[model samples]
Target chain A: MKARVHVMLKTGVLDPQGEAVRHALGAMGFDKVEGVRQGKVIDLELAEGTTEAEVAEMCEKLLANTVIERYEIDLD
Target chain B: MKARVHVMLKTGVLDPQGEAVRHALGAMGFDKVEGVRQGKVIDLELAEGTTEAEVAEMCEKLLANTVIERYEIDLD
Candidate 1:
């Protein structure tokens, strides 16, 4: 089985990196780009039968900085 | 309109950050974790009617390091 976790900065938190990207885009003449929010994706190959519960635990414990980020999980 | 770009390392390339996260997960007792790959997500708020082609161009020109990364774009 596999699990994909998408971790993103929570709304209302400042994202300097994202701001930088937006600025870069504007400078490159991609002026139509209004905002950019950067995030991370963690792709995990799990042992058979590994549950979503355990993956969520991983997100909470290590994969995401829950104070400033929130995560979504997709299983396959 | 909005678009999401997912950028990932080419399979043959090395990913030290992914390796570091894998090590941390193992140390934290996620022994069932067989592999871990890390990537980035860029969420873009685009002007209405922004085409996928423009977003793809952005990926090639700025959003991703084309020599070492490949990107997938989703528009909505």
Candidate 2:
């Protein structure tokens, strides 16, 4: 089985790294870029029979900081 | 318009960060995790009508290191 997690900062939280990228894009002449948000994607190859619940548990336990970030898990 | 870019290390490239994550997961008791790969997802809010070609150019020039990473652009 395979699982993928997408971890992103909460809407109201400040993202300095994303801000920097937006600023840099503007400076580089990509003026049409209005906003940027950066996130992480983790792909995991799991033992067959690993359940979606287990993947979600992994995200909650280690992959995501639930206080400031939200994570979505996709299983395959 | 909106665009998303997923940047990942090439298959042959060594991903130390991913390896570290896998090790941590094992220590944390996720023994079923066989492999892990970490990547970045950048979401961009663009001016209406921003073309996919422009997004691809951005990925090539700034978002991804072409020598070691590959990027996929999705426009929405």
Candidate 3:
């Protein structure tokens, strides 16, 4: 089994990293660019039988900083 | 219209950021945690009529570094 979880900054959070990208893109003539938010992806090759709820809980508990970020998980 | 593109390193690529997260999670007492990869998300608020293919082109041309990262876009 494999799982990939993506964690990112929540709306209303200030993202300096994203801002820097936007600035660079704008300078490169990408006027269509708006905002950028950074995130993380975790890949887990798990032993069979791991539950999706358990993985979601991991996102809530340790993988994501809920104070400023939201997360989504893809399981296979 | 709005578009959100999520970009991250492709599989088999070296991800030091993800490695650092795994190590941190392990130190924090998570035995199940495995690999971690960092990525970015860009959010755009566009005046209607932006095509998905065009957005994907922007992703390839500016938002993502194809040498390492792959991207997915969401339209709304």
Over 4 Å off, model 2 = none
- Poorest stretch of ten by lDDT in candidate 1 chain B: B12-21
Q: How does model 1 fare in lDDT? A: 0.94
Model 3 chain B lowest lDDT segment of ten: B29-38
Each prediction's whole-model lDDT (CA): 0.94, 0.93, 0.76
Q: Give the candidates in order of lDDT, highest first.
A: 1, 2, 3
- Writing each residue's lDDT as its tens digit, candidate 1 over A34-69 gives 999999998898999999999999999999999999
Give candidate 3 regions above 4 Å deviation. Answer: B26-29, B33-35
| lDDT (10s digit) by residue, model 1, range B19-75 | 888899999999989888899999999999899999999999998999999999999
What is the DockQ for all candidates, taken in turn? 0.90, 0.89, 0.44
- Which model scores highest in lDDT? 1
Pairs that collide, model 2: none
TM-score of chain B taken alone, candidate 2: 0.96
Q: What are the runs in model 1 whose C-alpha is more than 4 Å off?
A: none
What is the per-residue lDDT of model 2 for residues A4-45, given as tens digits with 9 covering 90 to 100?
899999999999988999999999999999999999999999
